[model samples]
Target: MSLSEKVKERFRRMFSDVFFKRYILGLWMMAEGLVYDMFDEKLHVIKTLPDTFDRIFAGGDYGINNPTAFLLIGQKANDFYVIREYYYDSRKHGRQKTVSKYVEDFQSFIGNDQPENLFLYPSAAALILELREKGIKYVRGADNTVIDGIQLVSNLLSNKGGRLFAG
Candidate 1:
């Protein structure tokens, strides 16, 4: 493939670092898009989820003074579903949870569901340590690639081919 100098310069100016690396260097990169304006429940929601999943995973955000959240996600092929969510707000609840208490709650939240991995926000060091110390397996810090994650989600949700959806 080849491009004129003008076109190359325009590409360089228009793309972000990640996009430039992918497009110009023949490597993977990211794109720009939005999903909030495109959300439609009629298109995205489903009444039932598959009884079995090809993969199961969980994501968690730890908070001492703010809000903590955990999502249990199940996937079958290209489809994803949020099977359950656990959320707690310290301000609304009137008190903070001890690290051990949070861990106990997290374990209970997991219950019989076996998640292949648990991805926690990268900066949630305290929670990560507590979970690890409690003998949790496959716990890893989440990737901090914000733009890449957003673009991928936007494409999956808004793409006309309907390759992916979350319920």
Candidate 2:
């Protein structure tokens, strides 16, 4: 079936169940452009990205207490997909995680699959250096313009009929 039909059916199914009324109402609010101005729940499902994507990229945002995130993204044409992530809060570790430790996890996360591009937040410069020192070259700084990036991602998630999932 077509995507629009799928969306309509999905909503209808949700609306049919009284227990899901609140969630469906929220979806209506979003469909009317009244809520989640940057969210695209369609792309948040558990599914795989298309094989047309040729490049894999990884990016990191570092934080000692706050959750530090590393996303592995796949890109095809001008579209993007979030394939996987390594999200952690050092507080959960019971102590602040060192840059070396984060790098070690990052290495294990990527495994033998070296990404074509690696972007790191400025705060992760030490981790970037450590990665390079470990001979895992190919790192760059991510241009993390929140508003602009959100707008772009929202647009892509709406227009591109593809799947992206991360855990």
lDDT string, candidate 2, 1-167, tens digits: 33587786787775533224446444333234332343444445546567656888898888877888988887776656777778898677777888888889989988866799888876677888998998888888878787886666656655655434442
Error of 1 at 2 (Å): 54
What is the Cα-based lDDT of residue 55 in candidate 2? Answer: 87
All candidates: TM-score? 0.72, 0.68
Residue 129 in model 1: lDDT: 92
Which regions of candidate 1 deviate over 4 angstroms? 1-35, 159-167
Model 1 / residue 158 / CA error / Å: 1.6
RMSD, model 1, all Cα superposed? Answer: 10.6
Colliding pairs, model 1: none
Model 2, TM vs. native = 0.68
